[model samples]
Target: MAHEAHSHEHGGGEMNWKLIVVSAVFLVIGLFLDNVETFRFINPYLVLLIYIVAFMPVGLPVMREAWEQIEHERDFFSEFMLMSVAAIGAFFLGEYPEAVAVMLLYCVGEGLQDRAVDRARDSIKRLIAFRPDFARLADGREERPEAVTIGSIIEVRPGERVPLDGRLLDAPAAFNTAALTGESVPRMIETGHEVMAGMIATDSIVRLEVVREASESAISRILKMVEEAAERKSSTEAFIHRFAHVYTPVVIALAVLVVVVPWLASLFSAADYAFSMWLQRALVFLVISCPCALVISVPLGYFGGIGVASRKGILFKGSNGLDAVTMLDTVVFDKTGTLTTGAFRVEQTVGLSPEDLAFVAAVEAKSSHPIARAVVEFMQGKPLATVDSACIVNVPGYGMTCGEWAIGTLRLMKKQGIVYDEALNEVAETIVAVAHDGRFVGYILLADTPKAGIFTLPQRLKAQGIKLMQVLSGDKQALIDKLIAGFHGHGFVKGYGDLLPEDKVSHLEALKKEGKRVAFVGDGINDAPVLALSDVGFAMGNMGADMAVETADVIIQTDEPAKVVEAIAIGRRTRRIVLQNIVFAIGVKVLVMVLGVLGVATLWEAVFADSGVALLAVMNSIRPLHRPRFEEK
Candidate 1:
């Protein structure tokens, strides 16, 4: 036992929980042996020595910490000192079993906390592993992604991730975009499509013409966001840290008063007094009020929340953003490129055969116009008939013309002397009027379409306690009405259109004046001002754009507005669990401290109040890492 104490003293033992288990087992055996006439020692001191030996392994680490605090930092009132005083006082009081139990429980609790922290940080470590470190050049030279120059070509082989943000050279391929978009379905791409750095080429070796340097890649920028995420603490986290600084010292001072005031009062009274009794009460008070849970558990919960969010492809700038999300009463959305896919898509096809549509798609495939691109995208699976590249002439103002089949606006139909019905002129939608030789084939109506996954988003946010949902757009009021009507107009959204960027800012300011905590969600590229102006700005659907990352409080790596619902759900759960830890931990500690001072609670209860509350708080802090209510994944 003497040798064990010497080793623990010099070895600088930390909170070694396995040693705690061993000591606990030794303590149980010592107590059992004390009851047996044959096994028990005759000398009471030798019997007490067994308990003392059991206490040494668990007690020395905390004693070492208290001594180091006194020696190096000159601070004697830390939590370690409080626990040390309590354990040593219990030994002096001849509460040998409790003296062993307190340190054992405290070490186990602390060890559990360290394990939770390591578990929470696992997601970040996964993020670091997720990044593709090396790029392969077309010539088979391997280089670090950051060293690769812009416009240089890199090869992404089968089962390898793209190493930089670049355009596909010539081969059409399928890529697993789950790292960027959070969608598991493979994204099929054509020759000129821009592929992001982390996308894994599913089947074949595909090459990319590097458009952005590796440092500027989406994954690199996201990594930067995540690594620095915990620096800005939540208001709750900040308050606890500040509270601990004053709270621990006050606890120690109160503990001293607990012993001294009673002894002073006894000096003036006729009542018999013992120094040991008052000192024991003070020691229990110190043990019960160490503030371990209050100091560490809040940040543990928030850090886990941040790590979990990052793993889901949602990057919160800090835990403060996570806290802010719970308070949002209003979520305002920008219509263009946010709620709706910004580009034109085929909304309707009138009088056009599937063959005519296919023919038209083949011709429009040659043009880079938004409407033409939309047509080709709509016909993704349908076979496109071949177009004659030799005689294909793109008239600047109108549209494309192959030999016999001409697909363009009505003006092109008039120019080609192809007579179309007068009703074609009355069509409100932007249309492609197809002409076969001199006969008019039917036209296709193109419109900007709403995204697929956002129908449940508004109600979900409302259920999250967000009161108002609205859209702000620069499009015409009529167009905005049309879009809102598609969402079942009377449902929840209030539309404001014909607004400039300044108008959007003023609208947000007006909502703020109404005492609303607003979160504005927009394509982070163009809404920099509005993004920065709101209570919590959510930047949507971009991975590689620097402006998107810099402008918003939260970055949704995928382009789904439904992710906003997931973000709110995650944020609320994290903050809720953190508050639970705070209330439960502090409440138990306060109750136990009072009981300890009144002599109603023993060292056993005080130990439970200190470390047991901490263990429960730590367990609660990890709840945020589980899937939120709405999350299936």
Candidate 2:
């Protein structure tokens, strides 16, 4: 399902190299008959016949395409029609070599550009490589993922990919999300959490209850998006299409004027203007005015940019997504998944000895509460004291206890008459009070810890010309303040917490009214509406809700905030290269056309210049593909 029924095959078919080779042989013979002394006795019409044969092999396809466009699409000013006209005009002027060379070299250039585009597309289609061929059910029978109905229980052994999006059952297990997220670290998904398809189980065998069907999974949607991205053209592409429609017809009119105006002037004034000379100049004008370079290179540049982003695990929904990235002025972030891990972790310890932590960890290991799990996970790789589960006592609302130890809230301390610091009530984070031998020990402060590399991401976005960075979360105001204080040294980021989904939308609407181009980054599952409201919505994961997959403008598969800056950098690079091609192509064409009118440029000279400029523009358009790996600033 990931590889779909899309075919990249151009309607023109593959490069007609056999046809080109045959045509080249005939053209060479024609040249020998027209100019060689040994063939002076041959009839001139036979020499013309040889050249027409040379032209048909390469020329007929273009002529057929032009006729079809005119008959079917009513598009008379197409590049196909322009090249066909130029070829026939050269034949009318008795310049047989120039006539055949124009179409021949054009086919060559077109073939090269098509190959380059195919390679760029192949880079993005690498996503299909992550797909698994079969799903193993709990009964040891294998089936296609599409046949596995929702709510079915499936078991995936270690080193296997999850075939469908499902909820983890039984126990927590680690999964390697490198294929989806581009991050190499193994991620542990707790019991009851949604495990998306394409994640490889890294350690122990895990069982899952399918929550979504194979056709509705994240990988399927992403593959569909990648296939449609090229069709959803950017603003520049739309503009170029409109420009060509008007520009080509006008250029054709000017080429006619290049002949008729001179002839009319010779009849009125004392000027000696030959009709044949002016007609040849008009042929040069048509050859130079072909819009091949501009038309092909513009899309080539954007495709190259898309290819670069895909390699780094970033997916832009369309080329317009690339354009939107360049205009982002203000960036809004969802705190939990965007800046922090959104999971509780022990931040610090107050006066707690290693022995006390060990005792607390050993006692906490017996519980299924989130806070208890946080303590157990944090104590990993460290020492822990032994405690009997039979002797441990669980207080319904306070905390847990074991032999000679009481761990809970201030209420537990007061109930047991254990005295502790009353000032600790002022702490904003979750506080775990510890007691050893019925005496007050110390406490542990826990909160959602920041992700590994988010500290540097704010500074990098600012350096990339992002005007302001802000955070809006449903987390408590005090906790939000603490998180902001943690980032205070790194950069200036505005924080606003305790906002509901609707409140976030209202705040962004106000920002939009004030003319701020906003981009909001979130986990996408919980904040799909706010993401949809933003100018550019950046969703964090491939495992998010179906609404998230549909609403987001860009998907950061790696779940990294830093990828946004990289997307912007790529947009800027693509825009610069596209502009260069537009100016370069038109500038060269205009200059050559003027020289042709003044009789300073020849037909073959104009032909070579046009082909050379196209080749160079295409070379420049593909520069994004070979760009070095992005450096994290």
Candidate 3:
């Protein structure tokens, strides 16, 4: 997965502290001269002069934008339009202090929003920073990561980050993968194991042969996914954006009527109508009508949630995936490499002598299947004799053939007309039958252990109101039943076995037909179709295939089942915060606007309605940024 350089473009630039300081000085001077009789020697116009200067720096940018909205973009309903109109109207009405205060408060609010959004951007920026700038070569030469070529060896010393994705060339070493996976525990990697960039060498210095360029490394991909996630807005965010655009123009029209209709009506009647007062009231209405709160807060809430999830090693490709997780009623998980460790170990061997086991190991060594690798690993350190053999042939969905013998499934032996005296019954474990010259030699039993987190996942999800907890696998029904039996107290509802890849997709389709929003979790190439077909797809990042990464909506970098629970919790919290902001912003703005229309609310209250609510909503949006505690790995 090659990634382009991450874009660091934020909502806006850093706060203009110099501008703030100068404006504050002018405001203080204006206030002192206007209020203090001791300063009466200064002309009133001089005080107004100070105030105008104060307003220009902080308020000019906003007024300019409002002007551009009308003159160029033809967008007259912007918050800037409302604020600029209100502040200038106040100046015209001889409310000089109020006019200066209005724009000053708006500047403060804008500064706060800039800071809040920058904080959210920092969440992913910190991850991008994990990519080491330089790598120490095998010969003690330090060079830029981007300059390192493939097959070049690099040395990662203790406490130093691995610079690129590569194969370990040194002895087995422990590396801390928290930067990439968010799991604090160090993982031990064998000499030939593939090691991703961004992991720190925790125990000893390790040499690695670079397998990927800096841009194509795992860290690059993770950074790319997380940074781009903000582009995918949730339904709530999109609606608020649309609402703001439409709401602004309508409010402007209403503000116009507030000024014209009442003044016109008063001219035809006996009611005392001061045009200035009515005009001032319309200005207050404009201030209250600004849609800044809803526009700034809603998206911040989602981005905050995404930042939090990234810290937890969960990469939600978009806000849509984060949104979808909250709506999941049922989560479907693949058996291998998901709930259970995909690595198999030879548990037991039946009716096999030392020589026979060695011969089988030799035959299995010629193949690269996981089952074969398990057999080879199990036979390690054993004094086994290697037999000279002809071409090794692989039988799809069955086993492999070596010379005049076959080592594979019992069905393969049956297909080859090999008979065994042992009564073979389908069980929860994997069994590979070995034959010699069309005669049963022996069978080796292999088993994959369930991940530690899978034990408690079912019960936790059940407690969270997930109604049906099930496992779908292509393994035999007897094995699936046995695995399901162990999960009795864990709240597993059903187990579907003897399923092909398409069968899994069909089951998900059926669930969708039943109105169940399903999230499928898997890490293999075969899981790609079902992963894409599901409502939300969770791919185990550590061992996941390229296809899975490309298709799955969410990538769990740590490969922790507990993260599934964490993701759901994150989504729920994020959605809650988003709703809270929407309701609070809208609720506060509506109340203040009604009060402003009735002439009960002042310019001060209007400022609060526009900026205060925005500040509060932004503060509430960042609640998800707090680090969470997960079960021990």
Candidate 4:
């Protein structure tokens, strides 16, 4: 059954491709016949027969789509209507080939648009499938399977999906959250730490008392937002809708005037103008005024931009959100998952001699504690041999140890009968004390390291005149300061630590008050509030929290910080194409309308002005698909 559904989707894509090719062929032939009189020697009826044959595939889809919209009672007349009217008018004038050509070109443009929409929606749908259906709970004696329900308080074993939004009730465990944050490193979640659904447990089994029900959980809300956002139209699209309303009526009126005014002028002035010539010019006017280019290409350009973004691992909900990203002048990032690697690492090791340090590292290496991993990684590659110790213990929020070497905070070491050296404890970095057989060995300092491309990110944002780079996070002030010290001193970079989800939203609101066009980038379930409130929200699409991805204006599929730059570039490019299409479509139609009134334009010229302009606009709108510019690491 799944294979059948997949095949159906594949067939849909194939059909669109076939339609585009067929329509392009018809358009080419139609243009050729218009330019070369030799092709006109063929009986017009024979030409008309070929034209109608070419029109079927293109016309069928347009008519189907238009019928769907009409069924839903949509007031806006679709591009299909413009194509249909132009074709019917051509047939009325016995210009059969032109009628078919207009529908064919219009269908090619619609096919491209449909494909782009499908690509963007498919990218987002993949994220929706990540929600787990079952939860495992820790009974007093053994693990038991629990039926998943919204708001059900359940225990999560190590390496299991968090079943609901809840607070941790057990000891700290390492969390493999790459699926939510796009950063593959595991994060440590301690007691009182809030974890959302979709994050996988990596180390020890930690119980979470569910706070939010499954239905009202962060993931559900985000999914709803994404689904709704797709329907929201942007300013340019709304303008196009209004333009079509006024433009369509005016053109219909002009077509009427074209027939009446020319015949009346010929009668009053006693000029030698033929009635057939005037009527032909009127038919040509109808063709030129179809507005297919503006109707088809503007939306197609935005749709193509969204598709291109999806290809690079960004999921834009719709064209409006995609368009808004280009206008943003400032970007605010969540400190933990957005700017930094969100993984704690050992920064320095101190205390015992090099060989003794290796012993402590070897023992600590087996543990999954963030501090333990940091310490072990610090001593990596050094020649160290140590027997496996008997008693391994972990002290949450402090450190861990094996046998006699006690690795923990200074307070923990003091409780273990080890004295903290005044000089050693005064270091600026995070300190974890080490004790050997009740004697002081030294301390290991751990910190959240910046991602590989982080330093360059601020510089790139600066170059784009994105003057604001702020971090809103729930991390401690000391940690936030230490993590961003290198970049935080800049006037444009600000760090706000100890922020709640609501705090981040409030901060973003303040930025808006200051007149900054803000874009919030985050990954956690907690980030959803700010994601929704921001002018534009960017989620680390790949490995980002489901709720955050759903709430975001754009999803960075690769979770690369630099892709934000690429998204902004796409928005700008799409806007440029939209403007060019509008200008070119309207300019040609206006010029041809003037020529028709002067009897200098023929029925063929009007058909080209209508369908050819639409084809040119559609082709131009898709040009950005070939010019994607991603940020370099």
- Number of backbone clashes in candidate 3: 1
Q: How many residue pairs clash in each candidate?
A: 0, 0, 1, 12
Alpha carbon lDDT of each predicted model: 0.81, 0.82, 0.83, 0.69
TM-score of each model, in listed order = 0.86, 0.88, 0.88, 0.70
Question: What are the per-residue Cα lDDT tens digits for candidate 4 across 1-633?
Answer: 111222232234776677657766865676576568788776666655656667777666665555654566563445445456656777777666666666654444444544543543564465476466766654443232234444445776776777667788877778766544445668787687778676788777677777776776545554655566446666887788678768866776777777778678878897776765666666667667765567557776776776566556566777788678767888888877777776777766665678777777777776776666777778778876665656667776666677666777787876777776777555555677777788887666777777677767678886555777877778777666765677744777778887888888788888899998899899999999888988889998655787887788887856787878777777877887899988888889889988987889876566656656766786787776666473322
Clashing pairs for predicted structure model 1, backbone only: none
Model 2: residue 335 alpha-carbon error in angstroms = 1.3
Worst lDDT 10-window in candidate 3: 1-10
User: Relative to the unseen true structure, what is the C-alpha lDDT of residue 334 in candidate 4, on a scale of 0 to 100?
Assistant: 89
What pairs collide in candidate 3? 428-479
Q: Distance (Å) between predicted and true CA of 278, model 3?
A: 1.8
lDDT digits (tens) for residues 1-633 of candidate 2:
000110122223444767777788998999888888989999999988888898988798778777767887788877778788888988888889889998877776666666666677777777787777888999989999999999899999999988898999968899988767767789989899988888899888899999988887767766777778888889997898778788989998999999899889989999998988998898889888988788888887888888888778788888898888888889998988777766689989888988889889999999888788899898999989988899999997789888788987777888888988888876778888998887888899898878777767667887768888888998778888887776663455888988998889898998999999999988846689889999899888654456775788888887777888888888888888999999999999999999999999998888888888887888898888888754322
Q: How well is each residue in 1-633 modelled by candidate 1, as lDDT tens digits?
A: 111222343332354555776788889977877777887557778768888888888788778877777787676766677788888888888888888888878777776676776788887777666578799999999999889999898998888988898999967999988777667889898898789878889999888999998777877777788777878889998898778768878988898998888888889998777788778888888888887787768888888888888767788889999999989988999887789877798889989988888888988888888899999999999899987788788988888888887888899988989988888675545778888878987889887778886667766776788788999998777677877777663657888888998999999999999999999988846688899999998887463245755888898877777778888888888888898998998898888888888889988888877887887887888877776454421
> In candidate 4, residue 252 scores what lDDT?
67
Can you write out model 3's per-residue Cα lDDT over 236-291, one digit (the tens) per residue?
87898889888987888888898888878888998887778778778888887777
RMSD of each: 5.0, 4.1, 4.7, 8.3
Give the lDDT of residue 223 in candidate 2: 76
